[model samples]
Target: MNYNGLFTHKLDALKEQGSYRHFLEVNKSAQHFPNFYYTNEEGVKRSAINWCSNDYLCMSTHEDVIAKLSFVSHRSGTGSSGTRNISGTTIYHRELENTLSNWHKKEAALLFNGAYQANTTTLKTLGKHIDNLVFISDECNHASIIEGIKSSGNEKRIFKHNDLIHLEEILQGINIDQPKIIVFESVYSMMGTIAPIKKIVALAKKYNALTYVDEVHAVGLYGNSGAGIVEQEHLEQEIDIVNGTLSKAIGVFGGYIAASNILIDFIRSFGTGFIFTTSLPPAVCAAATKSIQLIQRDDSLRKKFHENVLLLRKRMEENALPFSVNDSHITRIHIGNATQCKQLADDLLKIQGVYLQPINFPTVPIGNECLRIIVTSRHEPKHINHLVFSLKKLIYGDDTHNREIFSALSVADVENEA
Candidate 1:
């Protein structure tokens, strides 16, 4: 058995299946967000409007977040220096944890390097520690949750995405005396569909199972204070643990779990992923704290982001371009074939200056390939119009301009009325 041959075979299989990932190099400017510079295959620098960035609220480059980051970096130097137990815990970390706990209305919060770390560690730890822990997970949950559940060697059952009946059936089948946990996500990122948090919480209560809700995508875009869908539905208290990321909506690079003090302390003490890993930098924690503070104080950013989503949806509808329909801000255009998905993304970048990275298999199921479009607060009406027009022409071969689509609408006009 040749190790080199085995590795080559896997690479060949991926390439042949059109599932190989090629990351695009993009540099976004603080001055002109939503517009970025990317190098083409020929090494030519091209400008494009970003359509797939996870910087949902455009807070990554916000002045307030930048100021906090710069100040924290200056004061603390660079890295956290070691793992949390060693010399990593700082005033900023404690402050950020406090901010998170307050936001989620939880008893305490624990920081991890990222959402993947938090979810994986928390789930595995709970499964390992609890007696006869049974995991009931949503079928469409992100890889992080599934991996965490699997790694724990727990008895797991997967319910259909957002299918409460299926979930209830599984819950009913489990013994009432057995310890169990329900794992799901607030927002299914790839398809842009939201989970039914209230009903799920109710079921968890009836079955006496712990509930873990991953709100990575919803944290900065939903609810009164951008706490997440749980907050929006007034179910924050129902969830036993809430896992969130600072990378996506918060525009920083970290993740955290909000829960009761004992649960958090238990994870901190027992979870290998938490204990072995270096903590996130002080600057990242500070920036995330500032981002949360600013977002909580002002609902304007979330409103503006939704307005952009509406504008994009309206344009796509007017153009008759096929895309996934959901109330969430995500816009997913179907491209069933993987090769076609890749080609479509390349064509959009090279021809129309629209940069949306193609999402393919393992991230999403094969034959369900699609282009995920994330419209941010920084995207104007013109950008939305142009993106719709370009997508129509490239995908549907509808190049004819429909003046009615633009319709003299601007984000500023919408904001002014608000």
Candidate 2:
């Protein structure tokens, strides 16, 4: 058979599994809120209320951030021109790193082009230093962490999601003398559930292992000054390394790892991802620095963010939508089957103007297809009502076919109030 035919066959398989992804072209610019305009394949333009973006605090289109971008572009130019070890180490980059380190209360911080590169490079570099390194990771960690651990070519073990007993059992079973790293995210993106971070950090200490916490989804959105989950829980000093991203809540592009000065220096000396790639643009660095300062000073934003999350959760509960348990603003509406989930998402977009992307395998497990509705700070009560009304119509319709699942609303209510 021709190779072209085989490639087509693979594409067909993806279609059959409801896993094929197509990019939607945005005709208009993104707003400060969770809505944007897009042009469809039919060349028709439409406004869509987006519930799939990770812009939790809706800072991406803030006037201040945009103005800072403009100011930085005019002053320092665009690209960093080289790697950080080379010509990329501009004054803007240094200032941004310093700001981040101060925010997280870490001794130092180093920047990366993106969070994926940051996690992968940091894990790989740190893993190489220890002999017989054992990595204990959550089974539901993001793809970046999974790839990083696998690339390290070290012995690894995975525990059930948020199962502290399982994790401790594995830790106890492993040889205590060998170096280990307990890797996990502060917030599990897909499930919207927060890890038992303080407990995990304690376990790491008991095992004499280093802790690596990924705060990509939590940073610049949690704590008093948006320092992330560690700060929210007041466990900043307990975590060994904290990985974060500027592209999310900071509304800019780039990633960074905050740790002891020695660890940051170690990664700088050996991490191939940092040593090889061009540094973030000078404008991007400046934008991030400004955004960080804004987040630190803006307590009202965090309060509004939490209020929006509570409002959305309450509405979803009232509508009797099936959802996972979560403490954060991220909410996953479980649609069960893959095809139905995709159809539901498409219906929400085309019929109701809601643009929630269907998350299917392998982002989730084979049977755990869901519509991950990310509620941002900018979403108002009217938006929450609109989502609830549309979802209720689609899920319940005239008949009560989903009564069993609808009964789960009480659980969501309790969880939300908790």
Tell me the TM-score of each prediction against the true structure: 0.94, 0.94
Q: Candidate 1: what lDDT?
A: 0.89
Candidate 1 residues lying further than 4 Å off, grouped into runs, are 398-418
lDDT of 2 by residue, 12-33 (tens): 9989998888676654355535
Clashes of 1: 0
Error of 1 at 353 (Å): 0.7
Best by lDDT: 1
Q: What is the lDDT of residue 228 in candidate 2?
A: 90
Each model's lDDT comes to 0.89, 0.85
Clash pairs detected, candidate 2 = none
